[model samples]
Target: MSIRRRYADCRDGQIHLREAGDPANPTICFFHQTASSGVMFEKVMARLDDRYHCISLDSPGFGQSYQPGEIPDMRFVADRLMEAIDDLGISTFHACGHHTGGCAAVEMPRAYPDRLESLTLIGPVLVNEEEKAEYRKTFVRPFEAEASGEFLMTAWKYLELIGAASSVDLHCREMADHLTARDTMPMAFSAVWNQDVEGAFRSVDIPLHIMCSKDDVLWPLFERAGEMRPDAKQSIVGGSDFQPDRDPEGVAKALGEFIEGLA
Candidate 1:
């Protein structure tokens, strides 16, 4: 598959995206985890090359894209995302998001119902006030940089713990994703923390596919998703927290089946 880096000018700001597969085919837009970027979707897109125009967008403040000041909530993130897609001349497309990206996935249908064919939310992470409070201490709140540089190592350690069973290459790439957006990690976390999982899914009129790794930090939330929407498709893939990275082939295979069914 041919891969190209592209950009789109949206209402909020310019956004970066990674494009692959053939544009003549149906489009499938992907979003990555908080503190992560489009890099994670490469393998998955490669697998879908002949069948779909796969795209992975870098969320504002997380990749080469500029932040949209104070995000406020997930709705704003969804709107900004749609703006970029619209600018790309994609009137409608299937949407996929992982972790924090999953929050945006659910919101996108609500933001632009007519523009979505389906939604695939991987490890949809939603935290209650108590979980948010605990994460705040770990910089779910705005992170204050320390001269001691513990903040920098904290990212690495967190990746190691979450992806303990993943390959070294996966860990290094994910670590880089966070370090590259060090300033906005908290902002992404904040948006995800405020998401209403049940409310968002309840509002989705389109078909949905929810999947998670047995080892994802948000696997429990993924289970809740199954309970909330029993009729929607669900799966438990094998991998650690970085399921997309650790199990791209599995992710892509599942995505291919789900998307083909949409046709």
Candidate 2:
């Protein structure tokens, strides 16, 4: 199936989306990590389009989406996304979020439980205040452009340190997405830092699925998530931070099975 890129209007502005599969099929929405866009799930969407209608969104202030005048919290982000989803005429759908997107995804069921059938958190950051503080110190540094183009190497090094720069092609794609959101990246990270991530994780009223890649930096967090909610389903795939990019088939197989099992 071919992926169609489009926009959905909301109060804040247009939210960009990349969609695949038939609209008549069960919908599964994807929200990507910070400094990235819906393209992160492009390959995974292709693999699952046959079984599910896949819609991956570019969060407000990221990708081709309109940035709000001010930094918005996770709840605000969630509401705006629901508004866009409403514009698509979707009443209920499964929510799958990665990293920072998981912060917003967890808020969806809390505010609009009826609209979300299930929640899937991939490489979720279920950290405590202390851990958050540490992350805030290390992970949210600004990626400013320098006249010498020195910042480009800085960004590349960071991605490489986090195991996201596996291939030159993949790194280039990530850099493109990263640069698109560079100006507003800190705001999104601030939202995540201030969010009650664990509280939102606990408040999920619908079915829950916690997933991660064994090679991801957040793999340890996946284990912590299981400890928090032993009842929620869990799975791990092969790949580093960019699981959908590096291991699309594995990501698709795991996600497809989890969603189908709920049926």
State in Å the error of residue 153, model 1. Answer: 1.8
Q: Which whole-number lDDT from 0 to 100 does residue 72 have in model 2? A: 65
* Number of the top-ranking candidate, with TM-score as the measure: 2
RMSD of 2: 1.2
Query: 1-263 in candidate 1: lDDT tens per residue?
Result: 78899899888789999999888899999998887898888888888978899989998888888776677788877888888998999988999998888888888887776998999999876566787778767657443568998866766777777873267777777767777787777777777776786688888899889999887888887887888788789877866767777788899888889988876
Which residue pairs does candidate 2 place in steric collision?
A: none
- Cα lDDT tens digits, model 2, 45-78, are 9899997999999999899999887666888888
Give TM-scores for every candidate, taking all chains together and pairing residue i with residue i: 0.94, 0.96
Q: At residue 224, what lDDT does model 2 achieve?
A: 94
